[model samples]
Target chain A: MLRALSVIVICGTAAMASSQSNPPNETRSSPATVVPQQQTPTKSTAIIGLDGVKEKTAGTLNVKDGKLCFVHSRNKSQISAAAIADVVTGEDSQRVIRGTLGTLSMFAPYESGRAISMLRSKIDILTIQYRDDDGGLHGVIFTMPVGAAEPIKQELITQGAHTTIQTAAVAARGKQ
Target chain B: MTNFFRITMCSCLFAMLSLAGPHLHAQRKDTEKIKASALKVEMIQSDQIAVPAAFQVAVYENLIQQLGKKASFLHVYRDGDRDAASIPNLVVLHTTVSRFKEGSEEMRQVTTVAGATSITIHCRFTSADGKLLLEKDVNGKVRFFGDNRKATYDFAKRASAVVSDKFSANGQS
Candidate 1:
C-alpha cells in the first residue's frame, strides 16, 4: 500500500513539471524574425519602478507616436523612446497562477501541498533604463506574457531606444 | 510487530528533528549581534566590469530597499545626501561588483539545471574616520528559479543578514 501511494505521488509530480516546462508562446526563433512590429498592446504586470502605476499593477503597454506608454485604469504615463538608454530583456518564473492557490495549498495534508506549491509558470522580463529631463537615471521593470518582451524590445529599438548589446557577433567578440 | 515499531520510532525521531531545526538556528543569531547607530549606503561601483545600466540601477535600488527593512541601523542614508554627513556615528557601506554572469531564464526553466545566474560583490563597512569595521565577499545567485534580477534581491538579503549579525542601531559596540 505504501509503495503504491509513493508511485502515485511521483507520477503526479512528474506530470505537473512536464506540463509547465515550456510556455507555449515562447519559441527559440532566429533574431531576425523576432523583430517584426507587434501592433496590439500587450498585457503586463509592472513589477517595479514604473513612474505612475503602483508596483505590481497590471497594465497594457504599447509604443505610440515615438514613445513607450503604460496605461493602468484611467491613468497613463510614458517615456519618449529617444530618452531610453538601455533595454534589457530577462527570463523569470513565479508560482503558477500568481501563487494564490499555491499559498492556500500549504494547508494540504501529507506534505503533498509542498510539491504542488513548487510548480511555477515561466515569465519574461523587460527592464528599461531611461534618463529624465535633468539627466537623472531611472529604470522600470515589467513582466509580460511569454514571448512578448523581444518584440516590444525590437519595436523600441526601431523607435530609437538603445541596448547594451549591439549584435550577437559583437557581443561574442567583446567576450573574447 | 517489531519492524512496525521501529518504523514508527524512526518517523517520530524525524518529526522531532524537523521541529528543532529553526529553534537551533535562532539561537545562533543571538550570539552574533553587534552595536551601531546609523548606516549610509554608497552607490554601487562597477569600474572593473561593464555591468548593464539596468543591472546597476537594480542592485542599487534593491540594496537600499533591503537595508531599510533591517534593524541594524536607526537611519539609512543614500549616496550624496547632505544629511548623512551630520550623523557622527554613521558607518558607510561600499559595494563593488567583483564578478557577474548573466543567465537565461528560459534555459533554466526548460532544462532545470543548465542556466544559473550568479554575482559576487565586495562589501566594506567603514567608520566616518575611514577605519574598516567589517568586510566580506558576498555572493547571490538564482540557480533553479526566478529572474536574473532576483540575484540582486538575493544578494541584498544576504548582505542585510551580514549587517544584522554584526551591527545594531540601539547601542554602541
Candidate 2:
C-alpha cells in the first residue's frame, strides 16, 4: 500500500514538472537583435514595415554584426542582413519646405502657391524586403538625402543582402 | 401501347433537361466570376504627384492589408510577386496619387478646423491582359484626429469597400 502511494505522488510531480517546463509561446517571432539605420551621425527618417513597428521613426541605420539595425531615440530594431531578399531604390522629389509650412504655402495668394510647389528638392528612397524567423515576408522603406541611399545599399549588399537591380539601373528606372 | 409509352418517356426526359439547363448555366457563371476574383495589388505610383515616399509606401502596404481583411479575394498577391503571373483571372490594382496635403499633428490638435490632411488617389483595376475592370477616384481624409498616414488607411478601407461591393469573392457577392 505504501509503495502504491509513493508511485502516485511521484507521477503527479513529474507531470507537473513537465507541464511547467513547456512555456507558452506568447512572444512575437521576430529578429532578436536591433540595428541602426543611419551610417553617419545624422539620423534619417525610417518607416518600419514590420507588424509591431509601423511608424515613421527618425533613426540612424547601420549594419552591425551582420544585422541591419535602426536606432531611434532609446529604441533599437534590427533584421539579419542575410534574411533580406530584395533591395529596391527609388528617387523622388518633395517641396523645399515641408510639414505645416509646406501645406500652409498652398494657401498663398495667386500663383505663389504654384511657384512654391516648384521649389522641390530631390530625395532617395530605399526599400528592403526581408523574412523573419517564421519565414514571413516583411518590407521596410526609408528616405534619406539625395546621395545617401546608394552607399547604404552597397553596404547592405556587401553584408549579404540581395538585390536584383544594379544601382545605376535603378537610378535610370527612377528617371523613367 | 408500347409506342405511346416510349413517347411519354421522351417527353419526360425533355422536360427534365429544360428544367436543369438554366440552373447549370447560372452555376457556370458563378464559377467564372470566382475564377476572376484573384487580385494582385501593385505598388502605388506617384509619378504625377510629388507624394512623399513614406506616403506612397504606406498606401501600398495598407491597401494590401485592408484587402485581405475586408475583401474576399481568393488570393492576394503583392507587387512583383512571381506567382501572380500564372494566375488565370488575376486583377491588378494600380493607384496614382493625384493630390496630397501633409498636415501638422500639433496644429490639428490645437486647432481642429485648421489642419486637415487629405489624399486623392485614382484607383484602376485591370485584368491580367490589361483590360479595364473598374476604375474610380477615391478620396481619403483625416480632419481632426490621428496622424497624416491615417489618410492612407482610410483610402485603403474605401478602396477595399469598392472592391467588395463590385467583385464577387469565393462564390459570394
Top candidate (lDDT): 1
Judge candidate 2 at residue B9 and give its lDDT: 100
DockQ in order: 0.07, 0.03
* Best model per DockQ: 1
TM per candidate, chain B: 0.77, 0.77
Candidate 2: regions farther than 4 A off: A1-48, A51-62, A65-176, B1-35, B170-172
Per-residue lDDT of model 2, residues B121-166, tens digit only: 9999899999998789998889875667789989999998887776
Model 1 ranges off by over 4 Å:
A1-10, A22-28, A167-176, B1-57, B66-94, B99-119, B124-151, B157-173
Candidate 2 has what TM-score? 0.53
Chain A TM-scores of all predicted models: 0.82, 0.67
Candidate 1: tens digits of C-alpha lDDT, residues B1-173: 99999999999999999999888888776665555678887767899987655566678767767877864355776666667777877988999999999886546654668779998999999997889988999988999756677889899899988887778765433
Q: Where does model 2 sit among the CAPRI classes?
A: incorrect
